[model samples]
Target: MTQSGFDTDRPVRLGVQLAPQHHDSYQVIRDAVSRLEDMGVDILFNWDHFFPLSGDPDGTHFEGWSMLAAWAEQTERVEFAALVNCNSYRNADLQADMARTIDHISKKGGETGRFIFGTGSGWFERDYTEYGYEFGTAGQRLDALAEALPRIESRWAQLNPEPTRDIPILIGGAGEQKTLRLVARHADIWHSFVSPDELPHKLEVLSRWADKEQRDTSTLVLSNELGRRDEAEARKLHDAGVRLFTHGVSGPDIDFDSVQRWLDWRDGING
Candidate 1:
């Protein structure tokens, strides 16, 4: 494990968010999934949204949880989840049940499962408008998320056969006051969007939050986007305590050439 400035001695792990949008066919996504797991990537992710976020507003898109269930049966190793599930879209207890079912399906024969519950307070208003959910204030949404997480955990515990393993809660976002505090209290993994330079400060804030929440920051895995970052920036982030680096890819026909560089970089660090 690489020694970051923080108390994290975790191994470097590579992840990719395969955007489930703009795909003309689902077969393209299936092939990409096979390739990513074969490439020895550590995690797989897809976003939770009703429409495309890039290219075309009306482009073809697939639902997140549905694909996640398929991934549960399809892949054998890599952990998978929505890049960040919108808590506003579904009932908290229902989300817990859905995740548990997927957890059960992901197991081959062992007692463990590879489902990461990556979620966030939603930001896309069109999804709310079309889906008939109220487009509430950001604070309200975050509050809802805060309220829902406990219910989800309670539901997990009450389920017939509890989740194969503690489904890792990966909370994504970097807002100092609310999001980071939630991450400190609940998240097993904290995925950040801030740049390398800003990471130290954000982490400092998170540390403070952890202290306040009576949680140890060392128990949380730090994640960051690997797409726009150069190797130097990535190393900088790594030094700051980030262990899980994620790059995102979109598809009709997805390519792996760009991703190969990240894989090699990850191997170089973890090898």
Candidate 2:
């Protein structure tokens, strides 16, 4: 196993984020889920938000956790979760319980389980304003997340049936001081939005925090956005220690062309 938490001998993995917005119906999202799974994508993700992040502000959108519950029962082989769950929307204990429930729900035909608890401090102020959540400052939200994570873990330990498996906690953020510190302390996977050129520096900062926390960050999986970046660009990120590449596709017309390209790229590398 490498220091990046990803096994160097294992195959590279591809993930697709089916943004649950601009879709006229749930059936569209459901079909995309099935197709992505059948295509052998490693993980599926949806964002935790109340409205659309792009295009029209009030466009057709679905709630994240509920859709995830439906996805749990709908898919058989693929792991799924919010690309980054909003930590401020729900109680920390409730979030833990919800993730545990989804973990069990996703198990099928003797399969262990498939749930990654990807979360971050809440952003998208519109989600807060319209939903009645307090839109606190960024630092305040990060502090809340720092305090809540341990409680979430504690609640998971106390849950009745327990999770089918140890749910992997994925924290998404690139904030050097607090976010990376929390990642060192709790996350099994750390996701960032930075480009290939910016990753090494961030990793260095993360390593410093890991040393301070006495945590082996080398075992932490590194993730980056797979957005319009071509295969060549992706290889640079891979060389920088990123193993999981995720592409976010918006709805109404969920295109798989880019996803297919990345999957092909992943296969070429793995082979």
Candidate 3:
């Protein structure tokens, strides 16, 4: 493991979150996934929500897990998952089984599956309200997530045909108290939206939590968003210990201009 907690030998990876909103047809989204994989993106992600996150609230949208299942059959190389599934949407055991099933679906040519289980406590009140789930307090939701993670792991163990591989668990959010502690305890990757300036402090806190939990967090991968950051900014983030960078692209018409720049940057770094 590197000093930053990620395996030093592993090259920097690029991920794109194709927000499953504002698209008129699944074919268009499916084409986009193929384009991304062809472009050599290491990971592909979609958000978990019932409605659009941007533009009109009731715009055209597709559910994340279903889309992921399609992606499993659609692409051969890209690792994919919900950017973060809402823990409150389904039972923990069910979620584990679904993840395992998708993991198997993604396998090809004697290769292990390429599925990552990225999840967190549900936060979008609109999803809960419209979907008929109680929009409980944030703390309450986090507590539920804390309780469910272990059960998810246990269920994975009990499944008849286990996951093709130890499906990586990526916990998203930057809540210093509950979220980070949970990340330390259960996550293989910790995704945060914190800005580059704030990352050092947050990582310090994560390290402290790992020490308290007695886990060797040096193997944990740090993830962050690409947004509008340029190469210099990305380098700073890399220097600060982040190796996995994801950029969100929304649709109607999807753009790959920025994604290409980031991919080029990643290639330069890896080379």
Candidate 4:
């Protein structure tokens, strides 16, 4: 049961964040995408960043959206997106249009495009500073995200062929005041980095925000990172209501063994 003392009918899903960093060849990432989809993970994520987020500060890193476009064409079954696309990096309407185009690219034989629009308020200052965007306050970024989301949705409505489906919006962050409120109003998935002990309070706050927004909280899927988590801890997290879990894998090389472990865990949990 969750913090709300209930269980959801939603099936468990596994996502892996394939960081577009520390790689010499884009082909390495391309190959990783093909193998991961074949391995049966449900979702694939690449973060929106200009440079390597870990290891060497100046290591080779690829831009995220273009890689996502490649992923859209490369993988058939798995949904893909930026783990959390930064709201500060692009124009809202333009973001919408780009997403719509990718949505079309991922379509197969009338199946809706396999894209998830996971987004967040911009946080990494280097991405903004190096790219010539203003590195504003966190609150301002959050406010910008809140404003831009509606514009994105509106633009999607006017697009030519339209998104293959109502592309699910996944919002990352657990800030109760602004982030949770935004999640209540807009997110289909709420991804958090907090520990299981902290999730209940956040969910309680989300419940309040959902009430304020007059939205049903039950439809909201909770997602958490599975980095360094063992099965017992993961089960605790699952009981606390997180159904979607994503483990991050970085390059020079993708961790196929760890990916297999997660798939095994996903199957075990679902069964």
- Report the Cα RMSD per candidate: 1.6, 1.8, 1.5, 1.3
What TM-score would every model get versus the actual structure? 0.97, 0.96, 0.97, 0.97
Model 3: residues >4 Å from true position, as ranges? 1-8
TM-score: the better of candidates 2 and 4 = 4
The reply for model 1, stretches above 4 Å from the true place, is 1-7
- Per-residue lDDT of model 1, residues 1-271, tens digit only: 2434354676789999999988879999999999999998899999999999988899999999999999999999999999899999999999999999999999997769999999999999999999999988999999999999999999999999899998999999999989999998999999988887788779788888988999977678989998788999899888778889999999766769877889999989877
Cα lDDT of model 4 overall? Answer: 0.90
Supply candidate 3's per-residue lDDT for 268. Answer: 97
Supply every candidate's count of residue pairs whose N, Cα or C atoms clash at under 3 angstroms.
Answer: 0, 3, 1, 0
TM-score of 4: 0.97
RMSD of 3: 1.5
Instruction: In model 3, state the lDDT of residue 214.
Output: 90
For 160-232, candidate 4 gives per-residue lDDT tens digits of: 9788899899999999899999999998999998898888888888888988999987778889999999989
Error of 2 at 153 (Å): 0.5
lDDT for each residue of candidate 3 in 19-65, tens digit (9 for 90 to 100):
99999999889999999999999999998999998899889999999
True lDDT of residue 146, candidate 1: 97
Q: How many collisions between residues are there in candidate 4?
A: 0
